[model samples]
Target: MASQADRVAEAHKTLYDQGLAVRTDVTGADHVHRSLQNGSSDFARPMQELATEVGWGSIWTRPGLDRKTRSLLNIAMLCALNRMTELAVHVRGAVNNGASEIEIRETLIQVAGYCGLPAGLEGVRVAERVLDAIREQQSGEKSSTAA
Candidate 1:
């Protein structure tokens, strides 16, 4: 029989695995590679681990909200908190979660009204950059496949 400690460790591993999957689905394999690789940094290693374990595993995996809703909520909250860097990342995540451009626009509009014009404008700028990258990447994929 597995010991209690063993069981706990196994569960943690399972959640970590699930978190990786969830993150990959939302952020793409490329983003995951850049953000969470073992070679990235030992100093910020614990940050990645905690994000994977607690944020992605515990909160994001919850059934109360779908991934798209969560993505939108993250955008709004990140804007409200003026976390433009994380907001940019989650904007990409929002697209991956199936949020349309108009949906993103509307969310930013609300952010402008509620959060402040500066925050909303900055969020829009970040989101536009992320969306432009997505469009360019998709265009490249389509062109490459046409060859």
Candidate 2:
């Protein structure tokens, strides 16, 4: 019989794999994975395990909504919640999931009406940073390819 720790480890691996596939970017996925793990403290381990298994594996792996739609919804929710850090992360995820810059701008505009101006403006700032980073990455990739 597998030990509880072994089972949990296996579950985390499975979920992380699923998350990576949906997220589609190694750096982003690694950031999420590291964040979920919290730290080396034993007390935090279970929370990390549960977050990975349930949040990433169970909810994110659901079939009803595709990754692109989920990314959009996540951006909206993160904005409403005033989670600027997470909003930045999801902005990258949204782009990876096929959201255009225009789509992101429109979403932020919609957020301004319902979630309020402060939250919407903060989201826009984060989106700009994320988009700029993406553009820089693309530029580097192109330059490397050209060489």
What tens digits encode model 1's per-residue C-alpha lDDT throughout 1-147?
999999999988888888988988998898778887753598987788778877888889999899999999999999989999889989999999999999998999999999899989999999999999999999999999999
lDDT of 2 by residue, 38-113 (tens): 6447888767556556766778889899877888888899999998987988898888878999999889989999
State each model's CA lDDT, in order. Answer: 0.90, 0.81
Residue 128 of model 1: what lDDT? 96
Highest lDDT scorer: 1
lDDT of 1 at 100: 98
Each model's Cα RMSD: 1.6, 3.2
Best by TM-score: 1
Q: Name the TM-score of candidate 2.
A: 0.80
**What lDDT does model 1 reach?**
0.90
What is the lDDT for 56 in model 2? 64
